[model samples]
Target: MKDLYYIFDPLCGWCYGAGPAVTALAEHAGVRLHLLPSGLFAGEGARPMNAEFAAYAWSNDQRIERLTGQPFSERYRSEVLTNHQQMFDSGPATFALTAVALTEPLREVEALKALQHARYVDAVDITDIDSLQAILGRLCLTGAAARLARPDAQLEEANIRRIGQARQLMQQLGARGVPSFVLQVNGQSRLLPSSAAFSDPHGFLEQVLAA
Candidate 1:
C-alpha cells in the first residue's frame, strides 16, 4: 500500500486551512495517511505574548484566511488569542489526538477532523481535559480518560517514533511546513506541491499516481 505522511499539529491554522485538500487526497487517492503530531508550541508552559508577537501572528493569520477562506472565528480572536493568559499550546490537543489513535486506530482521520472542527468552529478549548473528554464522548469513544492517562506502552513508543519519522520525511521531501504531502510509490518517495497551496490537490494526486 502507498503511504502519504501528513505531519501536522491540530492547532495549526495552516493545517486547518488545508483540511479540505487533505480530506480530498485521503478519500480519492486510496492512500494511507499517517497523521504525525509534531507537538508544535508544546512542551513549554504557557508563555506571555508581547504585543509584537501578537500583531505578527494576527497579521499572518489574515493572510492565511485570505488564501484559504477558512473561518477564524471572532470568538477565537477575542476569547483565545487576545487574552495573554491563555497559551497557544497545541500539546494537549496533540496528546488527545494520540489518545484517540490509540483507542480507535481505525477512526484516526475522523477523530482529527472532529477535533479540528471543535477547536476552529465550536470555539471549544481543546487543551482542557474536560473538553477533550467531551469530544471523545461525541465520537462514541469510551475509556478516553484511561487512554489519555495511560496510553499503551508500545503505542506511546510508536507515537514518539512517528514524530521523528515525520521530521525525517519533511527533510526528505524538502517540505518546509505542516500540511505538506509526500507520496511513496514502488518504494520511491515524491514530493507534492513543492510549496504549500490550497489549490491543485488533483494535480498532486496525478503526480503521485504517475510516480
Candidate 2:
C-alpha cells in the first residue's frame, strides 16, 4: 500500500481550504492517508484572538476562500473571530484528533474534516474542549469524545509525541507551514509542495502517486 501524510493545523484557514482535495485523496485505492497535526497554533504558537489578529486572519482567510472557494461564514467572523476571551490554540483540536486516532484509527481523517467544518462553515468555536466534545458527539464519535473530555496522561503523551514527530518531519523537509503533504514509498519520503493542497488536491495526489 502507498502512504500519504498530510501535515496540518486544525485552526489553519488554508487547511480548511485543502479539505476537498484531502477527501479526494482519501478515496484513492491502495492508498492509506495519514493526518499529522503540526500543532502550528498550539503551545507557544498560540495567541489571544484580539482585533489585530482577527483582522489579519480574516484577510488571509479571504485569500484562501477565493483560491479554494471554501465558505467562511459571517457568523464565524463576528462570533468566533471577534471573541477575545480565549486563546487561538490548536491544542484542543489537535488533542481531540489524537483521541479519535487512538480509538478509531480509520476515522482519523474523517474526524479532522468534521472538526474543520464545525469551525469554518458551521461557525462554531472548536478551540475549547466543551465545543469539541459536542462536535464529537454530533459526529457520533462518542468514544473520542469521552477520551477528549477526560484526557488521561496516556492520551496527553500520545498527543505530544505525535505533534513532536510531525514537527520533526517538517524540519527534515524544511517545510515552513501547515497543509504540507509528504509521500513515502518503500521507506523513502518525498515532500510535496504545499500550494497544490490548497489549489488542486487531485493533481496533488496524482503527482505524489506518480512519484
State which candidate has the highest lDDT: 2
Give a tens-digit lDDT track for model 2, residues 60-172: 99999999988898888998899999789999999999999899978888888888888877878888899999988988899999999899998999998888888888899
All candidates' TM-scores? 0.84, 0.96
Per-residue lDDT of candidate 1, residues 20-124 (tens digit)? 767766776467877887665666633555666667767777777787777777776665666676567777777777777777766777778888888766778
Output the TM-score of candidate 2.
Answer: 0.96
Error of 2 at 197 (Å): 2.0
